[model samples]
Target: MSLINSLLLLFIAILISYLLVQLMQWSNLFDKWLDQISKKEDPSFGNDTEGLLEVVETLPQFTVSDISGQLIGIQELIDNKKTLLIFLNEECEFCGSNFEHFSQLINNYKGKKNIQVLFQSNQKETARNFYDVYDGKFSVHLYKKEVISEVGINFFPAYLIVDPTHSIDLITHNPIQVAHSLNFD
Candidate 1:
């Protein structure tokens, strides 16, 4: 992708993230409601990501090499399980700003056998060290510049949830909205 297109995608990502945050915080939307007299919870007072994540057209067939030079196919990774593909770069300013949220997200899904978390970074030299921040809680892959574009990624700090059906379920840049998007419930 050219610099202009990349900048455009980054702008769009930031805008979408901002709009979602505004929507989430729209008029105490996340506030809790309780029955004062009955001392019971409100039946219809629950929050969910009912419409935040739209259906992704799915990723193309592509195989990427990890830091250890292992070729992992996207289809194979999603077989009989879900794969959370994280695209990040060590030098990305936006990525650096969201490190805390990313850390929390990694921690949330760490050691989850039912699903697989794969981290993709372009920093070859910092591949293993970059993940050390997360205590190597998940697998990190190093891919060529074209590989990210081949996978339809234009920006850093993006997340994709791929299901066993060979489709990308969710793609978002906001870490706070990840849980809402990953509705395994």
Candidate 2:
């Protein structure tokens, strides 16, 4: 009888262990499903290459100040010439590393294109310092933090090409590709 009792106890323990393992497996599967759903809901979670292909037809009306405290309207700038709007952040390492490349790109397209560097940050001085360090070659603007969210930008170093008709022609993260799309060298 004692042997039978011991066997029964062992069987129950094994059953419990199996059930616990199944439960864990189910939990893991559920977590994975949840993650997929989250990514699907958030467009920013996907690959940057895919995101860059989307063309933004219209831009939100915005008026931001340049480094010299002059107010500049987005529509007004696009009205004058084909504008290259480069959105950057002061604290972004990617922006810091690519500053010279961007400056060179601006210089390469100078007079041919109105290239503006838009820095959205509450710390105006930091943005100014970043512009000054880069020799202030491009037209730099300082905007409030909300401008980034308003533009639906998930990452820094985004480029948008606005034609004289005030329509956005190309929007991407790769500045070189954008320049190429516009037939810039």
Candidate 3:
């Protein structure tokens, strides 16, 4: 091959390699980038540190059904008080466990009269069954599958702590992890 042709191929290869590297970095394929930038520990990524529990600028609201088939609006539920929202699915095993943990927390803070516990389930009957199985007397509302996407939920058993205006204060997948940081016990 001619030297000019060889050099041209070399240049093309280098450009492709640079493009690939840039794509990976942009897509979060480089873990070291997160390690260097993230506030959490590099090795352990421990939950001991309090996460960013910021007040959300805009709140997403949806209407779901209660066990009794009563329409429940998330914004309406909060009224003027903070809300502890538990998003659960009957198919999720961890959600069941979280339900029990939430029950205890609810009982502990019963007299506070400011925070409301809302369990969002895919099915009304399924949620009711869980409520009955755990002997959970707390009321829950059933959410549709589309509603889940509407609220930008991509994980199961998500726990959202919202302030008086229905603005999110904290959003976490691990309720226990968040509870520990917040001294739920």
TM-score per model over all chains: 0.59, 0.63, 0.59
Clashing pairs in 2: none
* Preferred candidate (TM-score higher): 2 or 3: 2
In model 2, how many backbone clashes occur?
0
TM-score of 2: 0.63
Tell me how far the alpha carbon of residue 122 in candidate 1 is from the true structure, in angstroms, after superposition: 5.1
Best by lDDT: 2
For candidate 1, lDDT tens digit of each residue in 67-102? Answer: 777888767766757767777777554565565676
lDDT at residue 101 of model 1 (Cα atoms)? 71
What stretches of model 3 exceed 4 Å from their correct place? Answer: 1-57, 105-110, 113-122, 134-136, 180-185
CA lDDT of every candidate: 0.59, 0.68, 0.59
Candidate 1 stretches with Cα past 4 Å from truth are: 1-56, 105-122
lDDT value, candidate 3, whole model = 0.59
Candidates' RMSD to native: 14.6, 12.8, 12.5
